[model samples]
Target: MPSAFLLIGIPGIENGATWTSLVFCVLYVLAILGNSALLYIIKTEESLHTPMFFFLSLLALNDLAFCSSTVPKTLGIFWMNGGLIDATSCLTQMFFVHCLSVIESGILTAMAYDRFVAICSPLRYSSVLTYSLLRKIALAILLRAIALIFPIPLLVRQLQYCGDNIVLHTYCDHMAVVNVACGDKRVDNVYGLVMSLFVTGFDLLFIGLSYSMILQAIFKMPTKDARQKAVGTCGSHISIIFIAYFSAIFSFLTYRFGQKTIPHSVHILSSNMFILFLPFWNPLVYGVKTKKIRQRVQRILFYNQSTFPPSRH
Candidate 1:
């Protein structure tokens, strides 16, 4: 087995590694703080203990896991010039990164279903997404992600890497690692394509369908106020889904098909953005858009003020 792999951080901007490191560091900090705060607020707030908030909490955890999978090592290379990763370590990182991504996609699908139930059958929403059912959904998402991704490291381990072991991206990814292997990687590529199509692609399709039904239901509402309220509830989720999937799909397609035409820097930056942007912004989007979360976050941040409001007596 190859002992270690080198990560070639941004090709052309090699001299600007410090600047790149600083920017990523800031984003990582924001992601960590934002997700942590969201989790804390969700866990502590009694009124936000429903299925929707429960799923949002899971999303916050996923965002944390997803960003943590790669950013630290990426920062290690950019900040401290530690770029080499052992074969086993590289495989571990790739496994978690891909697994968390798949899990997040599944969670997004579940969230879409939650919205569907809420808007389509308000009376049945609680019964449909009870705590027990939510637990099962979460467990199924985890199991499916693990089962689908379990083959990746095993398949990758069988490859021969006689060529330069330099990964041209910021992190250790399946494609980036596979591209370096000297052996026939057609199976690996095919498996990846199949997984993407069956898993993430299916989730995106279902989310789209869910939203279509949601819109149809909202339009049928008798009053504009009711329609706006329904739309408002889904707005944050829609924003997050768009940011997450659009960036992810864009990066995936660009890596697979735009290597020749797209600028190297653009590809590298977009790939990083795909992994980092959603995690960094998801909490902010929900915290600002969801009134309950925003209020709880405010209370958490300014406990003293909330504890003792200005004297009106």
Candidate 2:
């Protein structure tokens, strides 16, 4: 077994690594600050303690995990040529990246269901998504992600890596690592495909169905203002959903099919962008679209007062 694998970050863009690293560094800092502030605001504001905000907090945390898992080493490779990642560390990173990806899909699905309940079945929203049930849903998301992704790294470990230990991407992506192993990779490939379809396909199907129901309910509302209000409520989540899924699908497709036609730099860069961009964008989208979160964030930054006024006894 190889001791450590080398990550050739953006193979053809070595000359521009300084600029690339700088851009990635700025984005990483922004993603961290944005998600941290989001988590903080959601945590402190009592009024924001609803099921929607609870799921947003989970998304923020997942974004943080997603970026932190890959960006530091990517920066190291880009700026300082530190691409060495040991077998265990690489597997650990791969596990978290893929696992959190699945979790994000699950969270988005849950949020869609939350919206469906709120817009389609308004009377039962609170009763259906009580905190107890919310905790259970969150736990299930975590468990399902782990159950699906845990076998991937194990499969990689079993393969004999007799060839070069250089991975042609920024992080220990499952297929990327498997490609470097000198063993039959059909099992790994099939499992990855099955898991991807099961997670992404399944989650997207439900999300689509939920939004279909939500749109149906919105149009049935008595007035245009009511329909607009319903859409307004879901705008931030829809923006986030698009950002997360679109970038992910683009990257996944490019890796699986565009390998021959797409430039290596494009592949590596897009993958990094997918991992980094969503975290940075999540807080911005929510803060700008969600009225309460926006006001609370503004107060935190521009004023020294608490997010909400204190309660009188």
Candidate 3:
């Protein structure tokens, strides 16, 4: 049934050739390959098994699952008039999308805490961020995400979608799907927003606050290299986080408060951009910021060079 579900929309209305469809295809490939590679690098490199990279692995996994669920369906709809997505498939997408989203936000907050202790309380960093603690945190994250999102889609199942299931966007997104409900979605929206704010929005605030304190701590520390290293480790994360949450907050606010003037194209683009670009940026920015990944990449290149032994000059 999931495979048989139809995505009725503008695409269903008898039209063809959307440039964005191609873009979504490219996005799907990048999301899969990019996140897969990140996971590979982390798994192969034992040194990367720290709490920081552990969370990185979780983030990568979530990205892989999250992107896989939506992009392919969207791409199919783009190429064909309308892709069939059964109600089961739609709810599944809704569940995984929100689940991954919450996990990503939670992991980011945990990483910020990791940074805080690493910088603020270096001597106690290892003890504070023990494997058991991280495992607990991860379990907490998973449980929280599951708890928050599972019901919304189940609630959706109860709604009577008698007609007009034509969603304008590529995939079965939350607001898009919920809008078709015959009953009031106000409770659903409010409840979901509360969870999102606590899980994602508030988490972002905490991460930022942690970084602010870290900045202050760095300034107080003597030695340029220390200051540079501390700040540099965070700059890439800060950049990626800024892009991710800015797009997210923009999309959320526009969906909620900025709907009047927000063009459909703008609304759609902003939402997809975060998931599309942010996932790719996570591994990339971390590779740049962390010396270990750069070293591993260099070694990989060198190993390939040795294997082929470049043509004699």
- Models 1 onward score TM values of 0.95, 0.95, 0.91
Alpha carbon lDDT at 247, candidate 3: 82
lDDT of 2 by residue, 239-265 (tens): 888888888888888878898999978
**Per model, how many backbone clashes are there?**
0, 0, 5
User: Arrange candidates by lDDT, highest first: which order?
Assistant: 2, 1, 3
**TM-score for model 1?**
0.95
User: Using alpha carbons, what is the TM-score of model 2?
Assistant: 0.95
Q: In candidate 3, what are the lDDT values of residues 179-221, reduced to their tens digit?
A: 7666777777887788768876679779979998999999999
> Whose TM-score is higher: candidate 1's or candidate 3's?
1
* lDDT of candidate 1 over 237-311, digit per residue (tens): 998888888878887888888989988778888878777888899888888989998788677668777787589
If both were scored by lDDT, which would come out higher, candidate 1 or candidate 2?
A: 2
lDDT of each: 0.88, 0.91, 0.77
Model 3 residue 274 distance off true place after TM-score fit, in angstroms: 1.9
**lDDT-better candidate, 1 vs 3:** 1
Best by lDDT: 2
Instruction: Please list the residue runs of candidate 2 whose C-alpha ends up more than 4 Å from where it truly belongs after superposition.
Output: 305-313
Superposed by TM-score, candidate 1 places the C-alpha of residue 46 at a distance from the truth, in angstroms, of 0.4
Give candidate 2's error at residue 312 in angstroms: 36
